[model samples]
Each structure stands twice: as C-alpha cells, then as structure tokens.
Target: MKIKYLYIGALALLSACTANDEALLPAGAVELKGITASIDNGSGASTRAVPEVKDAIGRTAFANGDKIVFTKIERTENAINPFIYSNIPYEYDGKNWNRTTTDPEKIYWTDGTSFHTFIGYCLPSAITTWEPDDKGVYPAELGAGKDEIDFSSLSEGNNEMAKEDLLLYCNKSALAASDGVTTNVSLTHALSNVRVIVNIKNFAASAIATDTQTKVIDFKLLSQPTRYTWGGGSNTLSVVKYADNNKKDIKLWCPQPDGEGTAQSKTFTFYGLTTPQNETYHGINGNNQPLQFSFTVTYPDPMNPNGSPLVKTYQGAFDKTVNFNSGQCTTLNISLNHKDEQMFLGAEYSDWSFVATPDLGELRKKSTYMTNVDETAIVTSGQVDNIDDATWLYHVGKKVYDIYGNDGESAAAAYCITSSLQMLAFAKEVKNGNTFEERFVRLDADITMQSSATAEDYQWKGIGEGSNVFNGTFLGGDRYINRLNGSPLFVKLGSNACVEQLHITAVGNVTNGTLAGTNAGVIGGCKVIDDVTLSGTPAGALVGTNTGTIHASYYTGAGNLVGTNSDGDKTGTIVGCYQASDITSFTKEFLTNFIDGTDGENPTNGLNDDLNAFYSNESNSKKFRTKFNYTFTPGSYPTLKVVTE
Candidate 1:
C-alpha cells in the first residue's frame, strides 16, 4: 500500500564522469549529478525527475545526508576483471555526493584504449553490496543468498520498509582507461515491484445468515519459487529459492508507494525479484499458479450468532503465469469471498515503469541434475505435501484413488531418486494418473525392482497403464534402473514423455505403450531400449507395439526392440504410426544412421533433441560422456560407461 506519509520521496543519483589521461598516476574523476539533463538549479545540482516519466510513484530526489556506494574497476595491463576500488563511499549533501568513508580510492584512467567499469547503488542504510566478479558481475560468487542485500528485513511495515528501497546501476560503457574521463552512473531498480490487493466478499457464511460476522485472521502467500538468488551485471538468476514459509509477511521490498485498503481488503507488496525469460512457473509448490496465497477468516457460528466465531481457511491457486520484467512496478489484484473462492485479476502496471522482465530460476521439475538438490523438499513429496487435498497424493491402501500416492517427493520437481522404494513411490503416482507432464524424474543411483518373481512380493508394475500414463520426462544422468520386474518399465508412455541413457536388465520389456491412445510408440520425443527380458506376453526388447516416431536409437539384447503390433487391442487403437529406425533387424542404412566414432559424428545423427541413443564419442574413439551425462562406445554393441557433464 502506498501511503503518502511513507512513500513521499525516493533518492536516486544521476551521475556522470569524464576522464583525462595523466602522465604520472593516471588518475581521473567520475562525478555524479541528478537524473535530469544537467539542469543545474542555480545551486550547481540537477533535478532528479526524468521529464518523460510523469505521475511517478514516488519522488526521485535525494533528501540530503543520503548514502550511495560506488565501485570502480580499472583495466590496466588487463589486471583485475572488475577491481581496484570497492564501495567508493559518497554521501548526498542535498545537492552533491560527498565522501563518507575516509580515503576511498579515486578513479584512474589507464589509457585511451584501456577501460574502467563503474558499479553503484543507493540507500546504503537499507542495503549492502559486494565486489564484482571477473565477468563484471558483483560478488564474484553469486546464488549464495541475500547476505549483501538481505530481503528478510523487508518484513517491517511499509513506512519503515520504504527507506530500504534498492536502486542499482552499472555503467554499460566504461571510462577510457589511464585517463580522467567523466562517466555517468544512473541508479535504477534492477528488481520489479509488485503490489498485491486482496478483496473479501461473499462468504461461505451464508449458513449463518445476516448474523455472520466475517473477519480476517491470517494470510500468507502460496507460490512456488517466488524468490531465488539475485545476480548483478550480465549474469541473470539461474538458481531457485522456494517461497514455502507459512508466515512470510507481505511488505514492499523495493522502492514503491503503498495504499491502505478497507477492512475487507488488505494491501502489501513484494520486490527484489525478476522473472526468467521464456519460462513458466512449474515448481512443486504451485504449478503455473500466480499471485496465490492461503488465507484464514472467521464468521459467527451458524448455531448461535453469539457463539465463538467459526474459523475457516482458504487456499489460492490460479492458472496464471508470472513473467514480470526487470525495473518496473506491477500490481496484482486478488478477490476473496464468503464462498471461500479466490479470483486473480492479472497484473496492472503502475505509474513507475521501465522494461519490466521478470527473471527467476527454473521452477519446472523437468529433467533434474543429480547434485545440489534441495534435500528438504525431497522428503515431503514437495509442495503437495502441504495441500490438504486427499486427491492430491495418497497411498494405495490409505487413499489409492488420489491423483497419486506419495512416498517421497521433497523437491519432487528436480529431486533425484536413490533407492528402489523411491522409484516405486513415483511410479505409484504415475499409476494413479498423475500425468506429471513436464516434470522430470532422474535416478541418482541404480534402482533394483522386485528381485524374485513371487506373488507375495509386490511386483513392480510398469510406471503407467491404459488408464494412467507416464507423461513426464526422465533423465538417467549416468545412473541405472536394473532388475526391473514390470512387464515394461514404462506402460503407455505419454506423447510428450521421453527417456534415455538408463541401463536396465529385466526379464521382460524395457518400455511399452502407445502415446495418448492415437497409435503412439517409439515417438519423436522418446528414446532408448536397453537390456531386456525374453519372457513377456508379446515379448520384445523395448515396446510391445510401434506406432509413433523413433529416431537414431538402438538396442543390443536379443529380440526386436519393438513387437509387430498394429491393432489397438492391447490398449491403444493403432493409429497412424512410423518408426524411423526399427530394430527387429539392423542394416547398413540402419548402421549408416550412426557413423563410426572414427569420423566423429553428432550423437543425435541429424535428429533433434529427442533423439539420443547408441551414443559414441567421435573425438576420443573410446567411449566418453557427453554433457548429457552419457558415455558409450561407438561400435556394434555399446556398453554404457559412467557419464558426466
């Protein structure tokens, strides 16, 4: 909420520096002024307002005694990538920047050919910064956390939070080195500001009639990956930090005005964040939902209006995407009613605007990297663990009909499975028609399914079936799933599903199923047919039927990779289908699709990203791993080796 008493004004320094090469020390001075076009107010200070941007959310002028931290990186003899001076202390004396720290290093131009980069930020009392890295990105080591400019302090009320607004700036063009040339440093917010408004209306209190007294008790956001490690300079955010706190108070963390709403409605804001480009919210907590939260409200008991008010809780979920751009203000309007329903009204850009591009980490639980996972999430079956919905996930005997049974899923989106039980738990979800969609399940270690063929032992059924399909992605990551007991490791592989680089030794098929019914098998987005079993109903190396597209994939075990089944009798009504590479038999052309490692060819073999089989290391001649964590020899029979990035 933008309160006039709180967001009256903000301080941003528009600075410029000119350098001249010195024959002696190569020293230069880089000065900063207001944001205007050198419009000196007869007092030697420029005004802070930009003429083009009117109706600003907050005033853009210094209140004197303000602090601005600047850093100068000198390029001499190609020395430090971004170094020389750190936090060149400067304080605003209402009109000019004065020194706050003693003897801060001065800017020195090396030569006309050499260059110097400048980095700066304002409102030092509310934030802090670190030295830049070799790539000119500050805090050489990033993604650690908000130690430099912690966002946690933002829990304070909007009035107090206003003082901590962060204004960041880094000169795109550096000063000519070895010379005292002037360079301008304009401080603008690198994070986007979002104002949230929640309106309460018609309630489930209808049972209590007019005597119902509805009141708000508590509120918290329910959104996935709302925050992540922040980065400066060229490096955008590449990692994630989940928003799982049940009590994270909402407050403006960036420079933006706030407004107070009525009792039925409340207002708060969040900042220090940007959305990643071309990506969607697919994390475990809140899949593709935006501006969501959990709220608690109370009303008079229906039995007696004077009785203690009955308490009720509500959850928010939306089919929305959060793609806010950098350096802008966006407002999110939400409405809650007595019916315990929520409506999200998208985003409304505020008066304070710029190129707002939200940049955050990948929220999708697609293909996971085995290491550096958020261990806590893996233990709780991810965000769904908090959802009270029995249909969200459950156990077979406990609640078998739920969308899926959860045994393990902490960071399910990207958590790696290390045991056979974990794999079984995930498969149970797939069996219950979870779909998984774009999620990724990776095996960190070899998973051994039921070892003995006994009716007493719960035989591991294939990952999916006619009613339920496995539509997510699977990355072997150089791991294996051996001794599989499922008739086929995966049944009814969904159209969008894929698997590769997983070594398996089973007594039956490796995989089977026609994509989503319309005669699908060995498709465009599917790969691999590893060690197989010889005793299946139709019996094959890979699948029982072939209908979809199969690229440059191969199988070494005895028997055809795909069984000759065209009728839909099995489960899928054999629709239009094709196999670019069928392996009932191999030929020179089949071999031709894969060039010998001697020539050094791309493993995809002219196919797109979906094709990855019979991998060969052309350069090494011997088996080697690709960035995809797969290693295999280039000959007729390729044995998988430990793969690494």
Candidate 2:
C-alpha cells in the first residue's frame, strides 16, 4: 500500500477578480509558509513528527473580543501506505459542513480511486498530509475534522488571538501519517492569529483635580491712642477717654474666624471719668474669616481735685516775752492767720493768755498785816510806834489802836481807862517815877533788896557797913546784884528793855566763868546753893550732860562738867544726873556696889562722864534728847499711849 499526502506550494492565487482591481481571496484561509508538523506517539513520550514555524505570534497586540476555529483530519490504517479520513463533521454554528457561514468552499476530500468535493467551499489554502490506520481499512484524513480541530483556537482570532492561545499550539502538527497494526494518524487546524482594538474614547478622565481656598480678615486702627492718669504720677496708654473724676470698666470684642476669638484685650484705668470712649479692638481669624468687633470704655469719677481747703490756726502769744503780771485787765494778743479765722469761736478762746496781780493792800503798806484788808490805814490805826517800846494790845474790829496818848497805865489798864482827864492826871504822876524798877517794886509791894537806896541816888548807901552789913550773906543773889550794879543804875522808862524770853547758846571751850550765877542761879533747873564749877563734869550751866527736859528756864553761859569718882562711877561736876527719874550715883562706894556684877545693881561704874559732857555742851542737845526718848520711852513710861490710826 502507498501513503497519501496533501501538499500546497506557496503561490499567490486569486479565486475571483473584480474590475476595481481588488483580488477576492478565500475568506476562511490563511497562508502558511515554512510550516512543519510533528505528531506524538500514543505514549506521549516521543514525537513521531515535529512541526517548525519560523515566525511566532507576538503578545503585545492581543486583547479580548476575538474568535478562533480549527479544522482537523485523522489517519486510521496500517499498510505500505496510509489513508486519512475524518469521522466527525467539523462544527460551525452547530452544523456539519458549515463552511457556507464563515469559510465557504474551504473543504476537500480524496479516495483511492477518486476525489470528492463540496461546491460551496474547498480545502483551506494551507494543506497538510494524513496517513492511514495500521489495518489499512480507513483512508488518510485531512482538513480540520471534529476530533482534530480545536474550536477554542479558531474563536480567538475572530477578533484577535490571545498570547496564551497561540502558546497552546505553537509547534503542534496539523497533519498525521500512520502505518498498519495499531498506529493512528490525525491532522489539526488552529486559528492562532489574533487582532486587538482598545476603545479609549469611551473612558472619561479621572475625577478632575480639586483644591480649597480659605478667606482671612484683619483689622486696622480706628483711632489714635490716648493717655490716662490713674493715681499719683502714674499714667497708662488708654484707648478710651476718661475725665479727671470718673472710673468705669472698659471692654472690647473683636470678630475673628468662626472659631477664633480675640487675640488680646487691653484694660484702662481713669481717675475721675464716669464713662469710657475711643477704644480700639484687635483679634485674629483662625478660620480665615473677616473680623468685626466693638469696644465699651467706662470712666468713673471717684475723687474730686477741688474738694476742701486745708487750713491751719495758731493761738496764744507767739512773741517770746509775755508781760504776765499786767493784772486781770491785761489781754493776750494771739497771732492769727487767714486759716485761723475760719476756726470756731469756742476753739479760739481755749488758747487765751492768763494774767497775774499782786495784793494791792500789801503793795501800798509795804508790809504784811495779820488782818485781812485792802487798805493800809485799817492796819495802821492801833499799830504800836515801835514793837520793842510798846506791847501789842488786842485788836478791835479792824483797828489796832496803840496805848500812846496820856495814861501811864499798864498795857491792860490803858485799854480799860476811858476818861481822858483822869488818864492824863494819872500819866503825870506816873511820869515822876516812871522807872521799870520803881514800877516793879510798887507792884510787888516789898522793899526786898540786897541794899536799900533812894530814888535819886546812884549808890546803895552802906552796902558793906552800917545797918546793911555785907556779911557774905548771899543766896543766889550775886547774879542779880552784879547785873544791876553797872555804872548807870537808872534805866529810862518807856525805853526798849532787854526783856525777851532769853536764850544763851554756847558751844566748845565754854567755861563756868563765862557765865556766872548769883544766889538765884540754877544749873538746868537745880537751884544753886554753892559755887558750882562745870569743869570735868557731865553738866552744863545751860543743860545737864544727860539728855532730858528743862521747862520755863534761863541759862548762863557755862561749859560742860564731867567727873569720875575713885570707884570709877562717873558724874557731871555741877549736877548729879537722872534718867527718867532713876538716880545715877557719883559716889565711890555706890559705884563699886554697882560694879559687883550683880543683877539687881545699876551698871554706873564704867559710865563715861567726859563724853556725856562734850555731847551735852557742844553737840546738838535737842538731838540727844530725841534719841534718848526714842530708845527708852517703852521702859520709862508704863502708861504711855502711842496713838495711830
């Protein structure tokens, strides 16, 4: 047997021609050049035939909306040659031999003795050979048959072929040859060529790009800034107007972005304005919105600059020297300023001057009176010419009449004698013998003299002979006698006499001879019977050397007398001493008895007479008496009363 094959040489052939010179080519056929095919054995491990193609499909031009179709044949015999045949019909739009729809006149067939054909379409321009079966019973098949054709490849190129579809059959065989005895041969047709077109005009540009813009607002100045004074010298910038007497709060609001408010606010202070004005405002707009604002400024008058005047006033004398003794009639001239005139009258007089005056009665008389009167004549009526010459009679009413006229009467009788003639008559008779001695003698009614004498005689006759014998018969008489026997025995009546309550004070180095005493002489209240010496004895002519009292007494000038007996008892030379009526002995035997250290005896033996004499004579005798009374008053007087409230 012999194998049959289908072949086609590369030739440009036209099935039909037109006057327009366009060649009418077969519609379902594609030209094939330098094409080779191979078939795989039943084991699929080796190819019996390999197909080669010089040009492969390009992938860039591929897209969706394309179609593809395949035509196939198979060989089913084994002989010295193989015959190829197709059992199933090629399908197009669900019909066999359907070339009339798309590829018309593209089918052909041949038997061993003859060839068969469809009038509508012939085999495609590209031809491939098919062999028979190993049994040599079936003819070799060619063209695309049902079993060999891949419709998926044909539909792809209806528009354009995808790269994936062409890749599926790149080296595949379109024909098959076979020998007898279990060998099969087949052929396949793949429409791998594809066309692509993209409709870019149908697409719209991606949403147009967009951006946002925002608005902003800013404010400019509305007024010029002013100055405000708050207090003292302090001043601050003020957008609001204020007077000197008002104070009020000021506020401002600035419009900004919907969310952003004021950037800053200012506060102003004023002294005396009640309302504020001329304020400026500022703010920021975060959302870039326009800004609008309002401001209210207030000034209050809290103080007045011209309220009250300050004033000062002065009272009393502003001058340095004040004539204070100008009597009650004197006036104080107080200096006054204009401010002082505004002061209340009651306050002004409170600082007036004071005046002083001397007693006019005292000034006129140049003397002080014991009576209360303004006139000196009232005090001078009964005043004695000389107080030494006449005694002060009792005052009558406001007068102090003296006993100066005629009556030579006593101070008591002169006031009692009222008859002027009788008073004069008595005065002449008294004038003849108006002597102090005569008057005293007449009053006593006794001639008791140491020697008797006449009124005109200067000497006491026979003072040492005759009937008045001086036989040393004196008893405290020498003192009076010696004092009266001075050269002028007569003392004028009405003359000032030395008859005051006398005191003779002597101190230090005093002696008994300095002060002598006659019979009536007494040493500190003890009558003197003999000539007493104050030498070396605790006694003085004025005061005993002991501290005590002497009442209604006189003293001669004699110093202290101090002595100590043989038994060491001390005594004053002139007077034995007593303290609160306790006799202090100067006898030796008595002193020795006192020194025997016995409890019942007086301790007079060691008494210091000289010390007692010096204290009594020279020291302050009153002080000694005061100290003695203070220390011994308790023991000395049992019934004494010390009165205190």
The segments of candidate 1 whose C-alpha lies over 4 angstroms from its true place after superposition are 1-67, 72-87, 93-95, 104-118, 123-136, 139-160, 173-185, 204-217, 223-292, 299-310, 340-345, 349-645
Give the per-residue lDDT digits (tens) of candidate 1, residues 329-363: 56666666555354545656543432121111101
- Cα deviation in Å at residue 484, candidate 2? 23
- Which regions of candidate 2 fall more than 4 Å away from where they truly are? 1-540, 543-645
Scored by CA lDDT, what does every candidate get?
0.41, 0.20
TM-score of each: 0.34, 0.14
The global Cα lDDT (0 to 1) of model 2 is 0.20
Task: Find the number of clashing residue pairs for candidate 2.
Answer: 93
Q: After TM-score superposition, what is the CA distance of residue 317 in candidate 2 from its true location, in Å?
A: 17
lDDT of 2 by residue, 1-645 (tens): 000111212332212211222344333322111111121111132111111211222222212222112222322222213332222222223211121233233221122212211111011222232222453221211112322211122123331111211211211122211111111122111211111111111111111111001111121111211222111111111112222222212111111122111111111111000111211211111222111111121112224324432222222211222111100111222111122232111101111111111111111111112222222232213343322222212234543343332121332322222221212222322333322221111010101121122333223221111111111111121122121111111111121111111122222222222122111111221111112334333333433222122221222112222112111342222222222212222344433332222335443321123223424675434322111111112212111111110
